[model samples]
Target: MITNFLLDHSALVPVAILLVALVCAVLGLLFADRRRILWALAGVSSLPVFALTLVPTVHTIDEILCTVQFSVPTLGAVELLANVALFLPPVCFAALASRRPVTMLAAGSVLSAVIETLQALVPAIGRACDTNDWLMNTIGAVLGALIAAGTAWLVDRRAQSGSSTGAISS
Candidate 1:
Protein backbone atom coordinates (compact mmCIF):
# COMPACT_ATOMS: atom_id res chain seq x y z
CA MET A 1 0.00 0.00 0.00
CA ILE A 2 1.00 3.66 -0.34
CA THR A 3 1.36 4.02 3.41
CA ASN A 4 3.72 1.07 3.58
CA PHE A 5 5.81 2.56 0.80
CA LEU A 6 6.01 5.92 2.51
CA LEU A 7 6.95 4.36 5.84
CA ASP A 8 9.62 2.20 4.27
CA HIS A 9 11.04 4.97 2.11
CA SER A 10 10.97 7.89 4.44
CA ALA A 11 13.78 9.74 2.71
CA LEU A 12 12.13 9.57 -0.69
CA VAL A 13 8.87 10.94 0.64
CA PRO A 14 10.27 14.45 1.05
CA VAL A 15 11.83 14.35 -2.37
CA ALA A 16 8.54 13.28 -3.91
CA ILE A 17 6.62 15.96 -2.06
CA LEU A 18 9.04 18.63 -3.19
CA LEU A 19 8.90 17.39 -6.74
CA VAL A 20 5.14 17.63 -6.75
CA ALA A 21 5.29 21.10 -5.30
CA LEU A 22 7.72 22.16 -7.97
CA VAL A 23 5.47 20.83 -10.67
CA CYS A 24 2.53 22.68 -9.22
CA ALA A 25 4.49 25.91 -9.06
CA VAL A 26 5.60 25.59 -12.64
CA LEU A 27 2.03 25.09 -13.80
CA GLY A 28 0.92 28.04 -11.74
CA LEU A 29 3.59 30.21 -13.30
CA LEU A 30 1.93 29.61 -16.63
CA PHE A 31 -1.43 30.85 -15.37
CA ALA A 32 -2.61 34.30 -16.38
CA ASP A 33 -3.07 35.53 -12.80
CA ARG A 34 -0.18 33.50 -11.38
CA ARG A 35 -1.88 33.37 -7.99
CA ARG A 36 -1.77 29.61 -8.04
CA ILE A 37 1.86 29.75 -7.02
CA LEU A 38 0.53 30.54 -3.59
CA TRP A 39 -1.52 27.38 -3.72
CA ALA A 40 1.52 25.29 -4.54
CA LEU A 41 3.59 26.82 -1.78
CA ALA A 42 0.75 26.51 0.70
CA GLY A 43 0.46 22.78 0.14
CA VAL A 44 4.18 22.05 0.41
CA SER A 45 5.02 24.59 3.12
CA SER A 46 4.43 21.66 5.46
CA LEU A 47 7.93 20.41 4.75
CA PRO A 48 8.89 21.26 8.30
CA VAL A 49 5.82 19.55 9.66
CA PHE A 50 6.49 16.36 7.72
CA ALA A 51 10.16 16.47 8.58
CA LEU A 52 9.60 16.84 12.30
CA THR A 53 6.62 14.54 12.73
CA LEU A 54 7.05 11.83 10.12
CA VAL A 55 10.77 11.28 10.39
CA PRO A 56 11.91 9.09 13.26
CA THR A 57 14.08 11.38 15.37
CA VAL A 58 13.33 9.98 18.79
CA HIS A 59 15.77 7.47 20.19
CA THR A 60 16.02 4.97 23.05
CA ILE A 61 12.39 4.15 23.60
CA ASP A 62 11.48 2.13 26.69
CA GLU A 63 9.20 -0.11 24.68
CA ILE A 64 8.73 -0.51 20.93
CA LEU A 65 5.04 0.27 20.94
CA CYS A 66 2.50 2.84 19.80
CA THR A 67 0.41 4.82 22.30
CA VAL A 68 -3.25 4.22 21.59
CA GLN A 69 -4.75 6.30 24.37
CA PHE A 70 -4.52 9.93 23.32
CA SER A 71 -3.36 12.04 26.24
CA VAL A 72 -3.63 15.78 26.90
CA PRO A 73 -0.97 18.04 25.42
CA THR A 74 1.59 18.88 28.11
CA LEU A 75 4.38 20.25 25.94
CA GLY A 76 5.93 23.59 26.83
CA ALA A 77 5.51 26.90 25.03
CA VAL A 78 8.25 26.36 22.45
CA GLU A 79 6.93 23.01 21.31
CA LEU A 80 3.37 24.26 21.29
CA LEU A 81 4.27 27.31 19.18
CA ALA A 82 6.31 25.18 16.80
CA ASN A 83 3.34 22.90 16.21
CA VAL A 84 1.10 25.89 15.49
CA ALA A 85 3.67 27.50 13.23
CA LEU A 86 4.10 24.35 11.20
CA PHE A 87 0.59 24.41 9.76
CA LEU A 88 0.18 28.17 9.48
CA PRO A 89 2.06 28.73 6.24
CA PRO A 90 0.41 26.05 4.16
CA VAL A 91 -3.11 26.89 5.27
CA CYS A 92 -2.53 30.63 4.87
CA PHE A 93 -1.12 30.27 1.42
CA ALA A 94 -3.91 27.90 0.42
CA ALA A 95 -6.47 30.44 1.56
CA LEU A 96 -4.85 33.36 -0.25
CA ALA A 97 -4.47 31.29 -3.39
CA SER A 98 -8.05 30.02 -3.58
CA ARG A 99 -11.46 31.69 -3.43
CA ARG A 100 -12.62 29.00 -1.02
CA PRO A 101 -10.51 29.30 2.09
CA VAL A 102 -12.63 26.76 3.90
CA THR A 103 -11.10 24.01 1.82
CA MET A 104 -7.68 25.04 3.02
CA LEU A 105 -8.88 25.07 6.62
CA ALA A 106 -10.37 21.61 6.24
CA ALA A 107 -7.26 20.34 4.54
CA GLY A 108 -5.04 21.65 7.30
CA SER A 109 -7.23 20.15 10.01
CA VAL A 110 -7.46 16.79 8.29
CA LEU A 111 -3.76 16.80 7.62
CA SER A 112 -3.00 17.27 11.28
CA ALA A 113 -5.44 14.57 12.33
CA VAL A 114 -3.97 12.10 9.88
CA ILE A 115 -0.45 12.80 11.08
CA GLU A 116 -1.44 12.33 14.72
CA THR A 117 -3.37 9.18 13.96
CA LEU A 118 -0.43 7.70 12.10
CA GLN A 119 1.87 8.45 14.99
CA ALA A 120 -0.44 6.71 17.42
CA LEU A 121 -1.22 3.70 15.24
CA VAL A 122 2.25 2.94 13.95
CA PRO A 123 4.81 1.85 16.53
CA ALA A 124 7.79 1.49 14.25
CA ILE A 125 7.70 5.20 13.24
CA GLY A 126 8.77 6.31 16.72
CA ARG A 127 6.40 9.28 16.90
CA ALA A 128 3.91 9.99 19.67
CA CYS A 129 0.34 11.01 18.90
CA ASP A 130 -1.16 13.79 20.99
CA THR A 131 -4.45 15.59 20.87
CA ASN A 132 -2.64 18.80 21.69
CA ASP A 133 -0.74 18.86 18.46
CA TRP A 134 -3.93 18.42 16.48
CA LEU A 135 -5.61 21.16 18.44
CA MET A 136 -2.80 23.64 17.84
CA ASN A 137 -2.59 22.78 14.18
CA THR A 138 -6.32 23.27 13.74
CA ILE A 139 -6.06 26.62 15.47
CA GLY A 140 -3.36 27.73 13.08
CA ALA A 141 -5.48 26.67 10.14
CA VAL A 142 -8.46 28.57 11.47
CA LEU A 143 -6.39 31.69 11.97
CA GLY A 144 -5.09 31.48 8.43
CA ALA A 145 -8.61 31.11 7.07
CA LEU A 146 -9.82 34.05 9.12
CA ILE A 147 -6.99 36.25 7.97
CA ALA A 148 -7.66 35.46 4.34
CA ALA A 149 -11.38 36.07 4.76
CA GLY A 150 -10.73 39.47 6.32
CA THR A 151 -8.36 40.39 3.49
CA ALA A 152 -10.94 39.39 0.89
CA TRP A 153 -13.60 41.52 2.57
CA LEU A 154 -11.31 44.55 2.56
CA VAL A 155 -10.52 44.06 -1.12
CA ASP A 156 -14.20 43.79 -1.96
CA ARG A 157 -14.98 46.97 -0.05
CA ARG A 158 -12.22 48.86 -1.82
CA ALA A 159 -13.50 47.75 -5.20
CA GLN A 160 -17.06 48.69 -4.38
CA SER A 161 -16.02 52.18 -3.28
CA GLY A 162 -13.97 52.72 -6.47
CA SER A 163 -10.88 53.47 -4.48
CA SER A 164 -7.38 53.15 -5.90
CA THR A 165 -3.99 52.87 -4.18
CA GLY A 166 -3.47 56.64 -4.28
CA ALA A 167 -2.91 56.73 -8.02
CA ILE A 168 -1.96 59.86 -10.04
CA SER A 169 -2.79 60.79 -13.59
CA SER A 170 -0.43 59.34 -16.15
Candidate 2:
Protein backbone atom coordinates (compact mmCIF):
# COMPACT_ATOMS: atom_id res chain seq x y z
CA MET A 1 0.00 0.00 0.00
CA ILE A 2 2.78 2.37 0.87
CA THR A 3 4.63 1.49 -2.27
CA ASN A 4 1.55 2.25 -4.32
CA PHE A 5 1.18 5.57 -2.58
CA LEU A 6 4.79 6.39 -3.21
CA LEU A 7 4.37 5.65 -6.87
CA ASP A 8 1.27 7.78 -6.96
CA HIS A 9 2.93 10.82 -5.48
CA SER A 10 6.55 10.84 -6.50
CA ALA A 11 6.38 14.59 -6.76
CA LEU A 12 5.87 14.74 -3.03
CA VAL A 13 9.60 14.43 -2.50
CA PRO A 14 10.17 18.00 -3.55
CA VAL A 15 7.25 19.22 -1.49
CA ALA A 16 8.61 17.41 1.52
CA ILE A 17 12.01 18.93 1.01
CA LEU A 18 10.44 22.36 0.78
CA LEU A 19 8.54 21.79 4.00
CA VAL A 20 11.68 20.71 5.78
CA ALA A 21 13.54 23.73 4.52
CA LEU A 22 10.78 26.00 5.72
CA VAL A 23 10.92 24.44 9.14
CA CYS A 24 14.66 24.71 9.30
CA ALA A 25 14.56 28.32 8.22
CA VAL A 26 12.02 29.10 10.91
CA LEU A 27 13.93 27.26 13.59
CA GLY A 28 17.21 28.81 12.55
CA LEU A 29 15.70 32.25 12.70
CA LEU A 30 14.35 31.58 16.14
CA PHE A 31 17.54 30.16 17.60
CA ALA A 32 20.22 32.11 15.80
CA ASP A 33 20.60 35.72 16.80
CA ARG A 34 22.87 36.23 13.82
CA ARG A 35 20.70 37.16 10.86
CA ARG A 36 23.49 36.45 8.39
CA ILE A 37 23.85 32.83 9.43
CA LEU A 38 20.12 32.31 9.37
CA TRP A 39 19.81 33.71 5.90
CA ALA A 40 22.69 31.56 4.73
CA LEU A 41 21.01 28.42 6.04
CA ALA A 42 17.73 29.37 4.42
CA GLY A 43 19.46 29.83 1.07
CA VAL A 44 21.29 26.54 1.49
CA SER A 45 18.14 24.57 2.27
CA SER A 46 16.40 25.98 -0.80
CA LEU A 47 18.94 24.35 -3.10
CA PRO A 48 17.98 20.74 -2.30
CA VAL A 49 14.31 21.59 -2.46
CA PHE A 50 14.77 23.06 -5.93
CA ALA A 51 16.75 20.04 -7.12
CA LEU A 52 14.17 17.57 -5.82
CA THR A 53 11.58 19.40 -7.85
CA LEU A 54 13.60 18.96 -11.04
CA VAL A 55 14.13 15.21 -10.64
CA PRO A 56 12.24 13.44 -13.45
CA THR A 57 10.69 10.02 -13.40
CA VAL A 58 9.20 7.58 -15.87
CA HIS A 59 5.42 7.91 -16.17
CA THR A 60 4.09 5.12 -14.03
CA ILE A 61 0.46 4.04 -14.00
CA ASP A 62 0.07 5.91 -10.76
CA GLU A 63 1.39 9.04 -12.36
CA ILE A 64 -1.19 8.73 -15.15
CA LEU A 65 -3.93 8.03 -12.64
CA CYS A 66 -2.93 11.16 -10.79
CA THR A 67 -3.35 13.20 -14.01
CA VAL A 68 0.31 14.14 -14.08
CA GLN A 69 0.87 14.98 -17.67
CA PHE A 70 2.40 18.09 -19.14
CA SER A 71 1.90 19.40 -22.69
CA VAL A 72 5.05 20.39 -24.55
CA PRO A 73 4.85 24.15 -24.19
CA THR A 74 3.35 23.82 -20.78
CA LEU A 75 6.19 21.53 -19.73
CA GLY A 76 8.68 23.91 -21.22
CA ALA A 77 7.17 26.82 -19.42
CA VAL A 78 7.12 24.89 -16.19
CA GLU A 79 10.76 24.03 -16.63
CA LEU A 80 11.47 27.71 -17.02
CA LEU A 81 9.14 29.06 -14.36
CA ALA A 82 9.75 26.35 -11.81
CA ASN A 83 13.31 27.46 -11.18
CA VAL A 84 12.32 31.04 -10.45
CA ALA A 85 9.15 30.23 -8.57
CA LEU A 86 10.72 27.44 -6.60
CA PHE A 87 13.73 29.47 -5.52
CA LEU A 88 11.89 32.75 -5.01
CA PRO A 89 10.48 31.96 -1.59
CA PRO A 90 13.82 31.19 -0.01
CA VAL A 91 15.50 34.17 -1.63
CA CYS A 92 12.70 36.49 -0.61
CA PHE A 93 12.56 35.14 2.88
CA ALA A 94 16.31 35.44 3.32
CA ALA A 95 16.33 38.94 1.96
CA LEU A 96 13.40 40.05 4.07
CA ALA A 97 14.73 38.40 7.20
CA SER A 98 18.35 39.41 6.71
CA ARG A 99 18.03 42.68 4.78
CA ARG A 100 20.61 41.47 2.27
CA PRO A 101 18.83 41.10 -1.01
CA VAL A 102 21.79 41.03 -3.37
CA THR A 103 23.83 38.53 -1.38
CA MET A 104 20.97 36.19 -0.69
CA LEU A 105 19.77 36.28 -4.29
CA ALA A 106 23.23 35.54 -5.67
CA ALA A 107 23.79 32.76 -3.17
CA GLY A 108 20.38 31.24 -3.83
CA SER A 109 20.94 31.23 -7.61
CA VAL A 110 24.35 29.57 -7.37
CA LEU A 111 23.15 27.00 -4.84
CA SER A 112 20.09 26.20 -6.96
CA ALA A 113 22.22 25.57 -10.05
CA VAL A 114 24.61 23.38 -8.10
CA ILE A 115 21.77 21.27 -6.82
CA GLU A 116 20.36 20.89 -10.32
CA THR A 117 23.73 19.75 -11.58
CA LEU A 118 24.02 17.19 -8.82
CA GLN A 119 20.55 15.86 -9.62
CA ALA A 120 21.56 15.47 -13.27
CA LEU A 121 24.19 12.95 -12.22
CA VAL A 122 21.64 10.47 -10.93
CA PRO A 123 20.67 8.28 -13.88
CA ALA A 124 17.29 6.91 -12.85
CA ILE A 125 15.96 10.39 -12.11
CA GLY A 126 15.56 11.06 -15.85
CA ARG A 127 16.13 14.84 -15.62
CA ALA A 128 18.76 16.37 -17.84
CA CYS A 129 21.02 19.15 -16.67
CA ASP A 130 19.82 22.04 -18.74
CA THR A 131 21.65 25.36 -18.69
CA ASN A 132 18.37 27.08 -19.51
CA ASP A 133 16.89 26.04 -16.19
CA TRP A 134 19.81 27.67 -14.43
CA LEU A 135 19.22 30.94 -16.27
CA MET A 136 15.48 31.01 -15.57
CA ASN A 137 15.99 30.17 -11.91
CA THR A 138 18.57 32.98 -11.55
CA ILE A 139 16.07 35.41 -13.01
CA GLY A 140 13.55 34.27 -10.44
CA ALA A 141 16.00 34.80 -7.59
CA VAL A 142 16.65 38.34 -8.83
CA LEU A 143 12.93 39.07 -8.92
CA GLY A 144 12.54 37.77 -5.41
CA ALA A 145 15.43 39.94 -4.24
CA LEU A 146 13.80 42.99 -5.80
CA ILE A 147 10.59 42.15 -3.99
CA ALA A 148 12.48 41.94 -0.73
CA ALA A 149 14.10 45.30 -1.35
CA GLY A 150 10.74 46.86 -2.10
CA THR A 151 9.27 45.46 1.08
CA ALA A 152 12.13 46.88 3.09
CA TRP A 153 11.68 50.28 1.52
CA LEU A 154 7.97 50.29 2.31
CA VAL A 155 8.60 49.31 5.89
CA ASP A 156 11.20 52.03 6.37
CA ARG A 157 8.85 54.59 4.85
CA ARG A 158 6.04 53.55 7.20
CA ALA A 159 8.29 53.78 10.24
CA GLN A 160 9.47 57.24 9.23
CA SER A 161 5.92 58.49 8.69
CA GLY A 162 4.75 57.02 11.98
CA SER A 163 7.53 58.70 13.90
CA SER A 164 6.92 62.07 12.23
CA THR A 165 3.17 62.10 12.99
CA GLY A 166 3.68 61.03 16.64
CA ALA A 167 0.16 59.50 16.64
CA ILE A 168 -1.65 62.80 17.65
CA SER A 169 0.47 65.58 16.16
CA SER A 170 -2.31 66.32 13.62
Candidate 3:
Protein backbone atom coordinates (compact mmCIF):
# COMPACT_ATOMS: atom_id res chain seq x y z
CA MET A 1 0.00 0.00 0.00
CA ILE A 2 1.15 3.50 0.91
CA THR A 3 3.78 2.01 3.18
CA ASN A 4 5.27 0.09 0.29
CA PHE A 5 5.49 3.24 -1.78
CA LEU A 6 7.14 5.19 1.00
CA LEU A 7 9.58 2.36 1.66
CA ASP A 8 10.56 2.34 -1.98
CA HIS A 9 11.05 6.09 -2.20
CA SER A 10 12.04 7.06 1.30
CA ALA A 11 14.83 9.36 0.25
CA LEU A 12 12.60 11.22 -2.18
CA VAL A 13 9.54 11.64 0.01
CA PRO A 14 10.87 14.27 2.39
CA VAL A 15 12.67 16.17 -0.34
CA ALA A 16 9.51 16.28 -2.40
CA ILE A 17 7.46 17.48 0.55
CA LEU A 18 10.04 20.12 1.35
CA LEU A 19 9.94 21.39 -2.20
CA VAL A 20 6.16 21.58 -2.14
CA ALA A 21 6.19 23.36 1.20
CA LEU A 22 8.75 25.81 -0.09
CA VAL A 23 6.55 26.70 -3.04
CA CYS A 24 3.56 27.22 -0.78
CA ALA A 25 5.58 29.32 1.62
CA VAL A 26 6.83 31.52 -1.19
CA LEU A 27 3.29 31.96 -2.49
CA GLY A 28 2.05 32.78 0.99
CA LEU A 29 4.79 35.35 1.48
CA LEU A 30 3.76 37.06 -1.74
CA PHE A 31 0.23 37.73 -0.48
CA ALA A 32 0.60 37.92 3.30
CA ASP A 33 1.29 41.16 5.10
CA ARG A 34 2.91 39.29 7.99
CA ARG A 35 5.86 37.71 6.24
CA ARG A 36 7.66 36.73 9.39
CA ILE A 37 5.26 33.85 9.93
CA LEU A 38 5.89 32.51 6.48
CA TRP A 39 9.59 32.97 6.98
CA ALA A 40 9.41 31.03 10.22
CA LEU A 41 7.56 28.32 8.43
CA ALA A 42 10.24 28.29 5.77
CA GLY A 43 12.92 27.96 8.41
CA VAL A 44 11.07 25.20 10.27
CA SER A 45 10.35 23.31 7.09
CA SER A 46 13.97 22.15 6.84
CA LEU A 47 13.70 20.00 9.95
CA PRO A 48 11.91 17.09 8.39
CA VAL A 49 14.27 17.06 5.45
CA PHE A 50 17.19 17.15 7.80
CA ALA A 51 15.80 14.28 9.79
CA LEU A 52 15.21 12.30 6.64
CA THR A 53 18.76 12.83 5.54
CA LEU A 54 19.93 11.33 8.80
CA VAL A 55 17.43 8.54 9.10
CA PRO A 56 18.98 5.07 9.34
CA THR A 57 17.62 2.56 6.87
CA VAL A 58 19.18 -0.30 8.74
CA HIS A 59 19.42 -1.45 12.34
CA THR A 60 23.21 -1.60 11.95
CA ILE A 61 25.47 1.46 12.10
CA ASP A 62 28.00 0.02 9.65
CA GLU A 63 25.93 0.78 6.57
CA ILE A 64 25.00 4.18 7.91
CA LEU A 65 28.56 5.26 8.58
CA CYS A 66 29.77 3.86 5.29
CA THR A 67 27.09 5.60 3.28
CA VAL A 68 27.80 8.96 4.89
CA GLN A 69 31.57 8.67 4.62
CA PHE A 70 33.63 11.33 2.91
CA SER A 71 35.20 10.32 -0.38
CA VAL A 72 36.94 12.07 -3.22
CA PRO A 73 36.33 11.72 -6.95
CA THR A 74 33.02 11.01 -8.66
CA LEU A 75 30.92 9.66 -5.79
CA GLY A 76 32.29 12.19 -3.34
CA ALA A 77 31.51 15.01 -5.68
CA VAL A 78 27.94 13.85 -6.02
CA GLU A 79 27.55 13.57 -2.24
CA LEU A 80 28.94 17.03 -1.75
CA LEU A 81 26.53 18.38 -4.33
CA ALA A 82 23.64 16.73 -2.50
CA ASN A 83 24.70 18.35 0.76
CA VAL A 84 24.80 21.73 -0.94
CA ALA A 85 21.30 21.30 -2.27
CA LEU A 86 20.05 20.18 1.11
CA PHE A 87 21.26 23.31 2.93
CA LEU A 88 20.72 25.92 0.26
CA PRO A 89 16.99 26.48 0.42
CA PRO A 90 16.79 26.84 4.20
CA VAL A 91 19.59 29.37 4.19
CA CYS A 92 18.02 31.30 1.34
CA PHE A 93 14.71 31.44 3.15
CA ALA A 94 16.38 32.57 6.35
CA ALA A 95 18.26 35.33 4.61
CA LEU A 96 15.24 36.50 2.65
CA ALA A 97 13.01 36.42 5.71
CA SER A 98 15.42 38.20 8.02
CA ARG A 99 17.11 40.41 5.44
CA ARG A 100 20.37 39.62 7.21
CA PRO A 101 22.98 37.75 5.27
CA VAL A 102 25.52 37.51 8.05
CA THR A 103 23.00 36.17 10.51
CA MET A 104 21.80 33.63 8.02
CA LEU A 105 25.33 32.51 7.27
CA ALA A 106 26.15 32.13 10.92
CA ALA A 107 22.92 30.32 11.56
CA GLY A 108 23.58 27.96 8.67
CA SER A 109 27.07 27.21 9.93
CA VAL A 110 25.91 26.50 13.45
CA LEU A 111 23.05 24.37 12.21
CA SER A 112 25.33 22.26 10.01
CA ALA A 113 27.87 21.84 12.78
CA VAL A 114 25.19 20.74 15.22
CA ILE A 115 23.74 18.24 12.80
CA GLU A 116 27.14 16.69 12.18
CA THR A 117 27.94 16.50 15.86
CA LEU A 118 24.61 14.88 16.65
CA GLN A 119 25.03 12.32 13.92
CA ALA A 120 28.42 11.36 15.24
CA LEU A 121 27.19 11.00 18.81
CA VAL A 122 23.85 9.33 18.22
CA PRO A 123 24.11 5.68 17.35
CA ALA A 124 20.40 5.35 16.79
CA ILE A 125 20.49 7.72 13.83
CA GLY A 126 23.13 5.54 12.19
CA ARG A 127 24.52 8.36 10.13
CA ALA A 128 28.11 9.41 9.75
CA CYS A 129 29.23 12.87 10.72
CA ASP A 130 31.71 13.73 8.04
CA THR A 131 33.58 17.01 8.14
CA ASN A 132 33.32 17.16 4.37
CA ASP A 133 29.56 17.15 4.57
CA TRP A 134 29.59 19.93 7.14
CA LEU A 135 31.92 22.01 4.98
CA MET A 136 29.79 21.52 1.89
CA ASN A 137 26.58 22.39 3.75
CA THR A 138 28.11 25.58 5.13
CA ILE A 139 29.35 26.56 1.72
CA GLY A 140 25.89 26.07 0.29
CA ALA A 141 24.29 28.18 3.01
CA VAL A 142 26.75 31.01 2.51
CA LEU A 143 26.10 30.92 -1.20
CA GLY A 144 22.38 31.03 -0.60
CA ALA A 145 22.76 34.03 1.70
CA LEU A 146 24.87 35.82 -0.88
CA ILE A 147 22.31 35.10 -3.57
CA ALA A 148 19.52 36.44 -1.34
CA ALA A 149 21.44 39.62 -0.64
CA GLY A 150 22.10 40.15 -4.33
CA THR A 151 18.44 39.61 -5.13
CA ALA A 152 17.38 42.12 -2.48
CA TRP A 153 19.82 44.64 -3.85
CA LEU A 154 18.53 44.19 -7.37
CA VAL A 155 14.93 44.57 -6.24
CA ASP A 156 15.66 47.74 -4.30
CA ARG A 157 17.59 49.20 -7.19
CA ARG A 158 14.74 48.52 -9.57
CA ALA A 159 12.22 50.05 -7.19
CA GLN A 160 14.37 53.16 -6.80
CA SER A 161 14.79 53.47 -10.52
CA GLY A 162 11.07 53.14 -11.07
CA SER A 163 10.29 55.84 -8.53
CA SER A 164 12.88 58.22 -10.01
CA THR A 165 11.60 57.68 -13.52
CA GLY A 166 8.02 58.34 -12.38
CA ALA A 167 9.13 61.48 -10.61
CA ILE A 168 10.98 62.73 -13.67
CA SER A 169 7.95 62.16 -15.91
CA SER A 170 5.63 63.89 -13.44
Taking all chains together, each candidate's TM-score versus the true structure is 0.64, 0.57, 0.68
lDDT of each: 0.65, 0.60, 0.65
How high a TM-score does candidate 3 get?
0.68
Clashes of each: 0, 0, 0
Alpha-carbon error at 71 in model 3, in Å? 7.3
A best-first ranking of the candidates according to their TM-score comes to 3, 1, 2
At residue 92, what lDDT does model 3 achieve?
A: 67
- Candidate 2, residues 1-170: lDDT per residue as tens digits? 53355346655544543553455444533433466765675567477565565545673222111112333223224345455556666776687778889998898788767755655555455555566666666776886677667766766786789999996796
Task: Give per-residue CA lDDT, model 3, range 4-61, as digits (tens).
Answer: 5645655654464346445643544452344586488556858755775567757546
- Descending-lDDT candidate ranking: 3, 1, 2
After superposition, which runs of candidate 3 have C-alpha atoms over 4 Å from their true positions? 1-34, 37-41, 62-76
For candidate 1, the lDDT comes to: 0.65
lDDT over C-alpha atoms for residue 95 of model 1: 72
The window of 10 residues in a row where model 3 has the poorest summed lDDT is: 66-75
**Tens-digit lDDT track of model 1 for 29-53:** 3331446667677657778779888
